[model samples]
Target: MVAPFPASFLLGLPVRGSRGERGRRPARCGPLRPPPGAQGSCSQRCGDQSGPCSCHPTCFGLASCCADIRDFCLEISPYSGSMMGGKDFVVQNLNWPNPTDSVICSFKDSIQTRGHVDASGRVHCVSPLLYESGRIPFTLSMDNGRSFPRSGTWLSVHPSKVSDSEKSQLVNETHWQYYGTPGTQGNLTLTWNTSALPSDAVTIELWGYEETGEASRGPSAAGVKPPTPAGSLEMGERRFQYDSGQQCCYTADGTQLLTADSTGGSTPDRGHDWGSPPYRVPPRVPGLSHWIYDVISFYHCCLWAPECFRYMNRRPSSDCRSYRPPRLASAFGDPHFVTFDGTNFTFNGRGEYVLLDAALTDLRVQVRTQTRTGSEGSQDRGTGLTAVAIQEANSDVVEVRLGEGAGVLQVLLNQEVLSFAEQSWMDLKGMFLSVAAGDRVSVMLTSEAGLEISLQGPFLSVAVLLPEKFLTHTRGLLGTLNNNPADDFTLRSGEVLPPSASSRELFQFGADCKGPPAGGEGGTALGRARWRPAAVFPGAVQNASSLLTYDSKFLAWGWWPWLGSATGSYAAGRATHMWNPGTWYPSFSSRVPCSVTEDPNPEL
Candidate 1:
């Protein structure tokens, strides 16, 4: 008599949403063993479209129907990552539209103005019409922009275009509007004239939240209540102290506006120092980049507790440890170093490069050189194959793509590959391959593909083992990536991530920290270190899935528990590393000092 787990699988994983809706899409997870290319012979989409049986879209965006092979260890299942079964797991609040003030008419209208809200709230506004080439499609005005209530219309996948194609596809909710299309670049296109309309109504929303669960079947009947998914505490590094009372803006050569000194240097640019005089001497565009608030501040991370990976019985916490080994990270500019080209190498110029070969075989490449060919084939295919660069020149460069392949596989900056193919392999087996640090590197292999390819020494190895809570030399909390915001795991401002780079849901984010959780201003004293592959907790204890995904964009999955045959031999399930963090947590207070919290103010 045990079957009841769906309260949305105890309200946890599954929270997808990226905005920009055409079809909206978001829910997907089908084929587990049926789609490899349609497997076996012919099913012809079941409807039999002649005799080809095609279903691939990743078998429905990537199989995993959960048929059973013991569910692949369900990843050490406690509940087996269950977002209920119905799946939706809600949370959305878009609202949008923040233009701020009023007037802005230019397109020879003569630079009209009157839109302000700057003091930090940010709302600059302006619209004079500058279409030098093509792009300016602003549509939203209860009257303001002068007359624009066309209300959604831009759906043209096919109809041949001349006009009516189903319409409704406009985008540009706010930011004044200007993206290239009417005369290009200086874009300013509009011809509305209905006398505008009723004052204002530029809403434009997209919110999120859709949790629906009902399929747990056990452990107390009502279902789903194994939640201890909150924080995996322990964080450091914040350094930024400097305030002598305020009012500081250096640039006479000492450089200091947003502060960050050690002599790193950078500043100037806000109207070229506007009217100049608050300190003097401005006006230099040599390479122009000015505007340095002196950045780089993160080191706060947490939220990843799908039971924290259970270990039970005893003997495990040295900090978690077990797989990843071979360190030296911190290079790519300001910290870069991971090179080795003994047998093949070549990349004259351009940009973007990253190579970390633990060596396997067959992966050689090449580009732009027969003596630097770039003067004929239309400059050798426009500036010598600026698009790709190989396969008889012109442009095509290296590509072996896949995350699910077919499209999205790019390369350049001296392109070349010839290790006898079979896919050179760089799917990230062990770890490390981050780009953007000088970009423009090279390598080669073309003697019959260098004999099929084989070179295990220059270092590029990866076995991919990261599940013991991160196995540590210490320096806790490392989970975050929610919507990314362009930081993408380099976290430093408030840092917190003990074991969760991104389990993928596009990249979830939800987990707050303020100390032990009491009414909310807590700060300091957090004891929650977790890593349950079955259960293990020996020192410190609140790494509840890195604080529930960084404070509740919520997504701390890992719940597999359905093994009931007594001892037929597949049981191994039990991981409960909980820490909820705030609906309760005071058990007497005492010694609690793991402070540091403030990332959008825990969402206010």
Candidate 2:
């Protein structure tokens, strides 16, 4: 009846069967659809009675080419499978070589799966499906109205029947599911079981449904698993701290100059006590050495000491009178009139006086006196008179008067009096005085019984206070001196001299004295126009030379010539002997010139 199956057929070769048994026999492969306009198609034909058709060249033939007619092909309805064919059934398996067809459903990027048929006849043909949402659709194909095997579909598994092995797999993989069954259209929905999944799991998985008849296939057939849901369980948040790099600031030590806040005072008002013994002049006349005269000429003595002619007998010209005075000066005296050999001044008579011309702001005067009991009948007997007065030239009235009485000294500032008890040494600070330019300061004994006042041996000293504003923009002495040292010499506080106090001669010794004796004048005749010879006792060359050399270099470099010594003058000659302080000498020549000797016997 079967026409006697060919021997090849008995040996397991493909053979054509009757049309009625075509459903039971393996279907022959048909020609594959050609690509659009390709002008070609698969060479083999189906249902051919000729020799066995060579459809499968290799073990597994090329995958079926499903042409997507529309961009929305992936959105096909699971129930209708409308994208396939109008009959609700498509050629899922073409000439497939299998005893029973199995559906292989795979998901792309959605919850639904595309139905496929695996020709291998393995029940476990469907691969694992991944879903972002908990709801998943498992699709299958029906065979001519026959229901699929209930044991092999996702719909067949009950929650209570889930095996321990499946439960373990779900827990280890952090996956969960809710079993679902196929509807009238063979479309099933599998919902993720939230109870079985960890709280951080954003997606759920429906691993291939392992029905009773399904074969166990490894992950090689499983599709790519979907990544965890985009925004779920962020692995804790990250935080950081930033720096701006400007946290701290500092400066090197000693770089900052002293400030008023740190010094506790706004002005440089440090005071000093002359406790050291007085320096003595050598027995030989100072400036007599040859080196002294040479250095003096080298520096042009007239430029520093215009009054040098008084002792040198040099020409007195405009050059000598036009010289500028030093910024600071100390008190000096003559040997005969008022002998102040550095320590003290000896006032021998009423005619003797010590005169100083300075733009003084604050003047501090210290004096020592010894009074001898004198005859009551003498002209200066009962009252010992020692006085210090400040006045203008040719003035009848004094601006300030300080005098010694019987047991105290009275200060009369424009007739207003401040008295202090007389002691062996008196320290008087005269502040807020209005001494101005061209003012004359005289220290004298107006009347003397047998009283002797000593202004030498540090017994008499004066400290001149500069204006407070002098250092307004100056950081230190360096700034003030580098600029004009004599910039502002006006007193910060002082009373102006009244016009009535002016006279033709600003200074006079006693009531009867017309003027100072020719050589008895205790001050430089050129007044502020001449520099005050630094009071350097013959033996004080070391200290004086050091100060002079320093001031000279400062002036030469165009800096303000500031000699910090409490008592000294800047001598230009010292600039030459800078390397040797011991050999340096005063600029003045000690030997009296013939011209000076001829004029008068001058006071030393």
> Which candidate leads the pack in lDDT?
2
Worst 10-residue lDDT window for candidate 1 reads 293-302
**Model 1 residue 253 CA deviation in Å:** 32
- Cα lDDT tens digits, model 1, 1-604, are 0111222222222222121213221122232453233323321131111111222221212231122211111111010111112111111111113333232212223323233323332222222212111112222222245642221111101111111211222233221122322332443222221222222432222222111122121211111121122322111112221111113455678645342332222222222211111111111110110111111010001112222122111112122134343222211111112212111111222111111111122121211111113235232211111111111112122322111122222332111212212122211111112222112212222111111111112111111111222222112111121222232222223343233333231111222222334422123111232111111111112333111011111111111111111222222111121222221111112222221111222211
Q: List RMSD in Å for every model shown.
A: 28.7, 53.3
- List model 2 lDDT by residue over 1-604, tens digit each: 0111111111111111111112453233344432233221122221111221111111012121222111101112211211111111223223333433334343322222223333343122222312111112343332421432111112111112222222222222111111121222232323333343324334322222110111112211111111232323111111211101111112355233222222211111111111000100111111111112222342343333444343233321112244433222233221122111111222222221223322222221212111233457334211122333343222212222223333333334332232222111211122112221212233321110011222332123332222233223221111122233332111112222222322211111111112222342213232212222222111111221111111123222211111211123444423322212322212212111110001011121
Question: Residue 183 in model 1: shift from native, Å?
Answer: 40
